[model samples]
Target: MATKLLTFVIFLAGVLPAADAAIDIGKVLGEHREFSLFSSLLSSTGVARATNSREAVTVLAPNNTAVVAALRGVPRGADTRALLSDVLSLHVILEYIDADKLELLAEGRSGDGTRVTTLLQANGKAQGRYAGFVHISVGEEEYDRITFTSGAIGSPWNATFEKAIAQLPPSVSVLQVSGFIFPPGVIPPQPRARQTSMPPAPSPAPGPMAHPPRQPLLPAPAPAPPRPTPATPNLTNTPPPSGNVIPIPIPSVDGGMNATLPSAAGHRVASSWGVAGLLFGLVVCLIWSL
Candidate 1:
């Protein structure tokens, strides 16, 4: 019995180290359907193999939706493969950070948050205080919320923690993030083209008539007759004829006799002396009769 126990113990010691030394990221991601595209990217970019050799590492895997969104407008070619490799490298961290460790770091850090180095630093693609670094922090208002922000200057890309995918402890920890965490100078996703119908063309305006209708004609108005003018009398000084003169009666005043005047002249002419003489004769006759 002592010989059999010694052989079993030796076998167990050899198997445990090999199991803990390497992790298959593709297998872990393949289990989840939502990470199918992400898993493919890791395989194609060779990020999965690179990650397996690392001692301790954390991966922020975006869902298929996020992968699709980030790939929008990106052309396919050798250059594209290199770009994707660099991007996936940035998503990997050199140290294992599980949900518990992330919460503890959040609680311990100030408002500036904690910075962690990524695989980019190991590959020598980037070097600096912020290059190949990502900032992880908890939301100020919502303590349960966590965010991953790009360390690149002036980069607006950020992703929120969705849920823990798998945790192998000291070896590997994969977490699902809301979207892609892009660094500076990386082109963002383009919007889908909308299918819209064109508006109908306006009807052509009516053209002027070729031949216009004629109007009916009416008779012209008659001219008015001329008015008659009166004749003016002649004003000449001429003597009257001798035989043609006719007498006209002139009435006297104050109960005296009426005197006779010559007609045929335009006007009557009784002298002043004749009028006085007639009045005087009447006075004499009146005295005699009394």
Candidate 2:
């Protein structure tokens, strides 16, 4: 009896751990101290809420200082509100992209300058007279040298891609970048020579381990192989040795699912109990008759 009670307790305990497996991006960003500015912008721009609400997505977030600098560079006459909103939109992608996936994409992205439209498309933010496209520069297929160079929407108006800051594994990824990936036509061509097409923007790195860094852009550590456990025997499925085992029905204990006999060991255990019950009942009848 005590052993049966112990088994049920073990099953209930497993439920709590399964709940932890879910990742909450909104809660994660809210608690992180370093994302104050970035998080604020995400809300103000509506990007944060949208991403958190979705199943999965990748975000390239600029730190507070980087965001400030990028905004500061906006020309005097341009609409600051519109530009800032667009800038914030540039940092996020609608699909989930983990570091390992990004690395693989970097190595083999159909880099034919394929343009990836961002969530910003909903905002009516477009580049040139054409639909906007963020082009991630895949330098080469090499392993260690792989990097994010720039994502360009226009001829020379390109946003620099920087290191990843934090991530929640395959579901949500965040990278710190320099400048806005959405280079709306507002940034006019420099001089008439077309001399500087996509000049590299230096990232204002805060520190190595800034803001307890949520998830560095680097690939997630490979998962450890699952450990093997000893196998147990089940009597329910095992062929009953002639009349060796008896079958009985019991309410399913699996949270309303059809009650199922335990595998090998559990089935054998139940059969033994049934056998003991029969022998005891027979002894009682015999004693009563005598």
Highest lDDT: give the candidate number. 1
Among these predictions, the greatest TM-score belongs to 1
Superposed Cα deviation of residue 52, candidate 2 (Å) = 2.3
Per-residue alpha-carbon lDDT of candidate 2 for residues 205-272, written as tens digits (9 for 90 to 100): 77776466577789989999999997665546666454543344554666453433435555776778
Model 1: worst 10 consecutive residues (lDDT sum): 259-268
CA-lDDT, candidates in order: 0.77, 0.58
Off by over 4 Å in 1: 1-21, 140-144, 189-290
Error of 1 at 84 (Å): 1.2
Per-residue accuracy of model 1 over 1-290 as CA lDDT, tens digit each: 99999999999998876555467888878888999999898889888888877888899999999888877756677877877787788899999998889877655556556878888768887645576788787765666788787776655547888889999888889999988776666555444565487789999999997887765597666788877787554345543455655654455677554654346341435465578889999999999999
What local lDDT score does residue 180 receive in model 1, on the 0 to 100 scale? 76
